[model samples]
Target: MDRQAPRAGFTDVDRESDPRFYIRCLDAQHASAFKQRYKRRTFDLLELRPGQRVLDVGCGTGQDALALAAAVAPDGRVVGLDFSRTMIDEARGRSRGKALPVAFVRGDVHHLAFADDAFDRCRADRTFQHLPEPRQALAEMVRVTAPGGIVLIVEPDHESRLFDSPYPDVSRRFFAFRNSSLRQPGVAHQLYALFKEFGLTEVAVEPLTEIATEYASIAHVAQFEGGMRIAQRYGVVTEEEADAWLAHLAEADRTGRFFHAFTYFITTGRKPA
Candidate 1:
């Protein structure tokens, strides 16, 4: 793959039309930590097996894709897709020289470049939230899945992150970001509804929860702080305000007054046999 020319701004205006800005979260090392925290949750939701074909939408660095590749060893295939060229490059590099056979491509999740009923099982982890039209994406996931195949959409419900923190400002700032990104998790409950709306059958919804005790070890906290810094760096937020928010979160953790928890909704449905 050729190196795409970098744009001037941090975020791409095309993100509203294209799924490019999500790479901000995907191309970071912190994503690996978050993936670990939710590994069991995602795997339980997938319920994959050998000789099965899987498609991992918004595969990021392809860690989840690699895991699926291992599950379908020898016979099964796993294809990972991301909209960002940088992420696809990293993903390809990650699977380089690996015995497992996997394919990584730069493509939009909302508009996948595949024929109908192409994959046995389709998954979009933490991808729908970034979508402007999540229901359309959900429908597409089901469309690309073979009949009787499973389509699973997994995401964190930000509303479930209410922690009883001693520092009020910590929760406040966190909630600001959460509230801004509210649309991402808002569709969690609607995923099943969308699945049914798209004529899928045997639909089901599952919830997974995890708690973080320490801030330093907490991936979400780190991600929040880094994102805030990015916003500051890009003039989205003032540096002083970002510093105050960071101080609050750090202080909350140091004083052992921090409490953090996230709930993930895994909604799955199967096409008619």
Candidate 2:
């Protein structure tokens, strides 16, 4: 069977105008749990101090940015930047009533609207996979960060995804479809080398792995329906096969046998002073 080209899901539309699609994916309860699990780890790596300026590129909905704002409170500032105006608006709306010193802006990562060495710290989470020119974005991140500032890049290695489905072939097809949909599905593995290439010092890469045993969490991670839809659309799997695959998962969830796992690379580097 020939695998079909993966259809663009959230990446297909202009997120600036259609932020709902992206918001829906990240607003799920399981998605929050997944984020909480890693946010602390990422923050610890940042070593943020009071009164330092921080920038969160591709700050979707401002969750991390809000957290950073709280960490840098009393005098510090945190700015959340995204290319999608609607996303920025949603982020700002979420910030209402909060006295956090965080600002949301619509801007491109490749051309940050900030002066060189303007921020004490910079980070982008799960953003590079969707970017066609992730290297350029990383360069901009390096450029805007002040000397000795930390730059953290956290991204998932989609090729490392694993699922315990009854139909291994269908699962394989689904994985294939999922990986093909990403702009740089394997960018996480390249973070270390990219940091070195950008002349960053004290580069470190940490792999954060997560396993989802419950249906809700697994569904959020696998994007089960979306993956099957893409597989069916591309002829990677028959509609019947896709249905059967989902049924197997549903049965596993009911039987307390559901399993899914993936790894994300959290790479951090310090800009040379």
Best by lDDT: 2
User: What TM-score would you give candidate 2 relative to the actual structure?
Assistant: 0.91
Candidates in order have lDDT scores of 0.72, 0.85
lDDT of 1 by residue, 143-200 (tens): 7899988888887776667655454554555455544643454667777778888888
- Backbone collision tally, model 2: 0
Local accuracy of candidate 2 as per-residue lDDT tens digits, 14-99: 53445587777666632566668787899999998999999998888888899999999979999999877767888999999999
- The CA root-mean-square deviation of candidate 2, after full C-alpha superposition on the true structure, stands at 2.3
Off by over 4 Å in 2: 1-18, 29-31
Top candidate when judged by TM-score against the true structure? 2
